[model samples]
Target: MLIDWFTVGAQALNFLILVWLMKRFLYKPILHAIDEREKRIVAELANADAKKAEAQKESNEFQHKNEEFDQQRAALLSKATDEAKAERQRLLDEARKAAVALSFKRQETLRNDAHNLNQAIRRKTQQEVFAIARKALMDLAATSLEERMSEVFTRRLREMDDTIKEGLADALKTASDPVLVRSAFDLPAEQRTAIQNAINETFSAEIHVRFETAPDLISGIELTTNGQKVAWSIADYLTSMEKGVDEILKEKDKPIAKDEPKPEEPKPETKS
Candidate 1:
C-alpha cells in the first residue's frame, strides 16, 4: 500500500474522540453508581452493630434484677417461718401451765368435800347411839319391884321433918287397904319388921306390911302403895351418865370436824 500521512492523521484523531466520548457518557457514570452503592452498604452495617450492642446490655441488666428479687423473697420466707415456730411454742407453753393449775384446784376441792362428809357421818352415828341407850334405861325403870322396898322407903320418909312425915302418912294411909307391898326381890325378916315399924311410926297408925318379889327391877328397890309405885335403879343412873357422856363427846368431836380427815375404822365405840 502507498503511504498517506494526511489521511492517517485524520483517522487517528477521529478514533481518539470516539474513545473520550464513550468514557464520559457510559463507563464514567456506571463507575460513579457502584462507588455510591458501596458507601451506603458500609453505613447500614455500622448501624446494625450498634443496635446489637445496646440489646445485649439491656438483657444483662434484666437478669441481674431477677436474681436480686429472688434473694429478697428467700429472706422474707425464712423470717416468716421462724416467727411461726416461735408463736406455736409460746401457745403450747401457756396451755400446759393452765392445765396444771386446773388439776391442782380440782384435787383440793375433792379433798375438802371428802373430809366434810366423813365428819357428818361420825356425828350422826354418835347421836344414834346416845338415843338408843337412853330409851333402854327409861323402859327398864318403868315396870319393876315395889313391895319389900316400901319398908325402907317409909323408914327414910319418917326420918324427914314432921311435914314430910305427914305427907308419907297420907300416902301410906291411902294404900293401907293393901297390907301387902310389892318388891322386885325378897327382903329378910328383920328388914321386913324394921320397914313395918318405920311405916307405922311415920303414919302414926298401926300398918301391916307384906313382901312380894319381882326380878325385873335390875338391882334396885321398888316400893308400891296399893297400885301406886316409886322406884330407883342402878341401870337408870348408868343410863343418865351415858347420855351425858355422849353429849360431851359430840361437843368434843365438833372441833375435829375442822381437822384433817381420817380413814375407815375398826368399829364404833362401845356404849353402856
Candidate 2:
C-alpha cells in the first residue's frame, strides 16, 4: 500500500475533464429543454384562461338579451289587452246610440200618424157643417119677415159699443156716398120708411140711404157706409156650432181613465 502521487493525480485530472464535458453538453442541454417545455405549458394555460373569460362574458350578454326580450313581450301583451278593452267599449256605445235613435224615430212616426187623423176629421166636419148652414139660411130667406128683419137690423145697429158708434157716426156723417142697407129680401115701402126713421132717431143725424137686395147675404142684414159695415149673418150661429163641435172633439180625444185598476183574471186550476 505504498502511495503513488503521479498516478493518482493523473486519474483525478481525467475525471475532472469528463465532468466538465458532461455538464456542458448533456446537463445544460437537458435543463434548457425542460425550461422550454415549462414555458410552453404556462403559455397554453394562459390561452385556456382567456378563452374561458370570453365564454363567460358571451353567456352574460345572452342572458341580458333574453331578459330584454321578455320585457318587450310583456309590454306588447299589455298594449294589446288595453286596445281590446277600448274597442269593446266603443262598440257598446255605438249600439246604445243606435237603439236610442230607433226609439225616437218610432215615437215621431206615431205622432205624425195621430196628427194626420185629427186633421182629416176636422176638415170633414167643417165642410159638412158650413154647407148645411148655408142651405138653411138660403131656405129661410124666402119667408115674409121683411118688416121684422128691418126692425132687427136697426136694433142691432143701435146696440153697437160706444167706440163703434162713434166710428159709424163719423162715417155716416162724412160719407160722400149714400149709406147702403143690404138684405136677402126686398122690403115694403112702410118698412123702408120705418128703417129710415130708426136710423135718424138712433144716430141723431139725417143720413141718405140706399136699399139693395143681395141673395148672397144669406137671410142676413148688412149696412155699409164709407167702408164701415155692421152685419149679422147665419155665420154667427155656425161659429157657435163650430165651438161646440170643437169641445166635443177635444173630449173624444182625451183618454178615458179607469177609476180602478183592471183586475187580472185568475188562471183556471189544473186538475193535476
Candidate 3:
C-alpha cells in the first residue's frame, strides 16, 4: 500500500488504449458480419414464404379449373341427354303417326271395297225381289188381283183421315169433270157399279163417275178428281224388305278395331 503515483498512472493509461483498440478492430467487425448474416437469412425466409404462397395460389387455380371443367362437363352431359331424349321422342311420334295413317288408309280402302260390294248386292237384291214379286203376282190371275185392288181402293177411300176426306169431298163438289176411276184392267160393269155406289155412300152425296183402263197401273186402282187421288200399289210393300236386307248386311260387315300400342319407357344411363 506504499503510494507510487506515476507508475500507477502510466499503467492505467496503457490499459485504456489497449481496450479502445480491441473494441474498434475486433468487436465492431464481428458485430457487423453477424448483422449482415442475419439480414440475409431473414430475406431468404421471406422469399421461401412468398414461393410457397405462389405454389398454393397455383394449386387453388388448378383446382378451380378442374371444378369448372367438371361443371361444364356435367352441363354438357345433361344437355346431350335432354337432346337425345327429345330426338328419340320425336322419332317415335313420327313413326306412330305414320302407323296410324297407314292403318287409317287401310281402313278406308276396306270401307270403299265394302261399300262397292254392298251396292252391287243391293242392286241384285232389289231386282230379285221385284222379279219374284212380279212372277208371283202374274201367277195370280190378273183380273182377280185387279178386282181385289179395286176393292182395297174403295176401302182405303172410306177409311181416309177426316182432313183427306174433307179435301176429296170439296174437290168432288167443285170439279167440273166427273171423278175418274183408273184400273190396270178394264173394270166390268158390275165392279164399276159397286165402286160408284161405295164412293157415293162414303161421301153421303151423289156424284158423276168415269171409268178408264190404264195398262201402266199394275195390280193397282186409282180414283182421282181435281188432282185429289187415292190409290194402292204392291210395289210399295217390297221396298221395306230391301231396306231391312241392307241393314243386316251392313251390320255383318263392320270392321273390328285394333288396340293401340303402349309408349316405351326410357332406360337410365350408366355412369362412365
Candidate 4:
C-alpha cells in the first residue's frame, strides 16, 4: 500500500464540508421541527391536566351544593308539617270550646223551661184541688144543717153594732112595702119574730115581714130596698181568701218583687 496523503486529505476535507452542509440544512431543520413538536406536546398535556383538575373541583362543589339543597328542602318540609299540625290542633281546641259553650247554653235554657213548667203545673193542680174540696164540703152541709145554723145566726145579729140596728130601722121605715129579707137558710119563726120586734121598737111602725132562702149565700142575711143590697156573707170571706192566694202566687212569680214589703190587711171593725 503506497500512501496517497493528498488524495486522502482532499477526500477527508470534502466529507467534512458535506457534513457541515447537512448539519446546517437538513439536520438542523429536522432537529428544530422535533423541538417545536415536543414543546407543543408538552403544552397540550399541561392544558389537558388543568382541564381535568378543574372538572374534578367543579364536580365536588356540585355534590356539596346538592347536599345543602337537599337539607334545606327537608327542613322546609319539616317546618310545613309542624305548622300544619299546630293549625289542626288549634282548630280542634276552638271547636271543643264552642261545643262546650253551646252545651252550657242549652242546659241553662232547659233548666229554666223545666222550672217554669213545674210552677205552672203546681198552680193548676192547687186550684183544681181547692175547688174540688170546697164543692165536696158544701154538698155535705146542704140539709139538717140549716136548723142548727139558726141559733148561730141570732147570736151574730145581736152582736152587730147598734148603728146597724138603727140603719135597719131607718131603711125599713123608708120602704114602701114590706122589705124582703133573704137568707142562706129559711128563717125560723122565733128568729123572724125577734127581728121584726127589734125593728118595730126603733121605727114605731108595723113592717110586714117576708122571708126567703137562698143557698148560694152560704150563711148570710140580705135586706134589699130601693134596689140596693147591703149584705154580709161567708162568700165575701172566701173571696178575700182567694185574693190572698192570688197575691201569693204573683209574688212567687216575680223574685225581685218579693223583696218588697207587703201591705198589712185592714183590721176588722169593732162592733161596740
* Full-model lDDT for every candidate: 0.66, 0.79, 0.82, 0.72
Considering only N, C-alpha and C atoms within 3 Å, which residue pairs clash in candidate 4? Answer: none
Candidate 4 vs. truth: CA RMSD?
A: 18.1
Q: What is the lDDT, from 0 to 100, of the residue 168 in candidate 1?
A: 51
Against the true structure, candidate 1 reaches a TM-score of 0.34
lDDT tens readout by residue for model 3, 178-236: 99988877888878988998899889989889999887664567889999998776545
Candidate 1 C-alpha lDDT tens digits along 16-55: 9889998999898998998888887887788778878877
Looking at model 2, residue 57 earns an lDDT score of 93
Clashes of each: 8, 0, 0, 0
Off by over 4 Å in 3: 1-143, 248-272
TM-score of each: 0.34, 0.40, 0.40, 0.35
Q: How far is candidate 2 from the true structure (C-alpha RMSD, Å)?
A: 11.3
Q: Model 1, residue 111: displacement in angstroms?
A: 26
| Inter-residue clash pairs, candidate 1 | 145-184, 146-182, 146-183, 146-222, 147-181, 147-182, 147-183, 184-214
Rank the candidate models, highest TM-score first: 3, 2, 4, 1
